[model samples]
Target: MQALAGFLWWAAVFLSPVVREATLGNLDPVAVAVFDIPLFVVASAVAAFGVKAAALVSAGWTGAVAVALAIYATVTTEAGWGVLGMGAATAGSLIALCLVLLGRVPTAWIIRGPFAFRPAIPRPTAASHVASTFGQIVLFWGFFLAAIPFAVAFLEGRWAVVLLFPSFAAPVGVAVLILASALGISAAVAMSTLGNGTPLPSAMPNHLVIAGPYRWIRNPMAAAGILQGAAVGVILQSWLVVAYAVVGSLVWNYVVRPLEEADLEERFGEEFRQYRDAVRCWVPRGSKTLRSQKP
Candidate 1:
């Protein structure tokens, strides 16, 4: 919810005529996108922090932003695309807040509802986890990066969605690439450095990791790839990628988690369950009083 809100808010900023005239006046957006790619990475951290803290301050800030936008819209009275886009964002944010408060988020299935981290090593777990981590990387990225060429080819051949490239598609796709890379790498680093394990159950960590990005969310690495896939779908405006994300999320929730948690229970016994029950899997319960295990 917070991720979407932040993205939409920034989208409004990018699409606003003032910004477009200031930065893109008679200039190609591709050049700007190249320079602005770093901003996309920063934006991911911003979103992570926002989501981690949203439940605390979202309602107040969102209401304030809405009123500010409403006054601006009233003053301008032109009802331009910018105002409309901003309204949509404000509306979405409010709705998301309400749902979050009610604990009825439409996306609950995609997030904290059915996830857990488990460390179980019946055998040569470390190598197995390392291999699994690498395999997951290949599996997710192979399909994710493949979308660019496929989108280019399919759209170019079918309907000639050429106009979508620089102005809309490229920036978003590039943003996803950067965000995904940062998140995925962070996840791996946290696991290897903090947990003394790889991402795979085969080489399950000797210690539970609640450090680095795991300090905020349980399935940071998994969520990174999944969210990246969804970002691609949004950028390309393709239901195929969106469908992949949805199906993948469901798979993670229903199929993958159960097996992983069972493995965890077998390996860690009551310890795994206690952590799972105490901490949320994806949507960041926020502000653990105790410090994480020191490296």
Candidate 2:
């Protein structure tokens, strides 16, 4: 996938001249051919050889190029097709960068050091957990749902893009939001009351929480959060916001979940392993079956 992303990025740059000519009228393509073409080709080639250093460099360079093109399209270009082209290029570059980094870097390196998951010593009280959960809700809803979406909308407006939801989508989004909120609240309550902790890693529950929503799914909070984010995007009808929510979920799943689970296994040993093996991470299973196999 990393190699494919690199090639796709190279291909996008290689065809920049034609894309620009078609969308923005006649433009000098010499600069791209002379500079970008050779640079990307060599970077992609070296990265394909499984060279970690080369992959890192390629990822950085491609990301920088993507940002530059996005800025140019948003600020300098008036053509819609040109903006779309730039968007595609930016997506390609970002995909390439993510793939390269994930493929090359060790999981331990990514999750350890400053990024390590360290649970709080001396479990927090019920009052403290309640306060922490409330704070988290405010931060997540205010920044991620409201502020970031507003920013994305502002940027999209610069390209003369208008996003709107269908009448039905608003109701559906509301339904999803309500359900997700309920699930998240339930999970938080379980963590606090039963597990004796907050949702934050720094104040994680000391005990394994297999009650309430955990009886069905391994990560009810995460699922609810991701669902809430997507519901907000649906309500707002912003593709960028939806993509942001999806990307955030992917990051949490691939990067954070493993470390979290590792910590759980280390602490709870066979108890956690049995629960994990029985329950699905995102999906809920039949209640009877889950209850029957309760670890």
Which candidate leads in TM-score? 2
CA RMSD of each candidate after superposition: 15.8, 4.4
Off by over 4 Å in 1: 1-140, 144-170
The alpha-carbon deviation from the true structure for residue 99 of candidate 2, after best TM-score superposition, in angstroms, is: 9.0
C-alpha lDDT score of every prediction, in listed order: 0.57, 0.69
Could you tell me the TM-score of candidate 1? 0.47
lDDT of 2 by residue, 1-295 (tens): 4445435644554477654443343334556546555455466667666566665665566556556655754675434444555455445544555566675335455655545666545544666766777788788778887898878766666654556767798789889999998999888888776676778776777778888899898999999988888888887777667777899899889978988998999989999998998888998777444443222
Worst 10 residues of 2 by lDDT: 286-295
Q: Which predicted model would earn the best lDDT?
A: 2
TM-score of each: 0.47, 0.78
Alpha-carbon RMSD, candidate 2? 4.4
Which regions of candidate 2 fall more than 4 Å away from where they truly are?
1-18, 21-27, 50-57, 77-103, 109-115, 160-165, 287-295
Model 1, 100: alpha-carbon shift in Å? 37
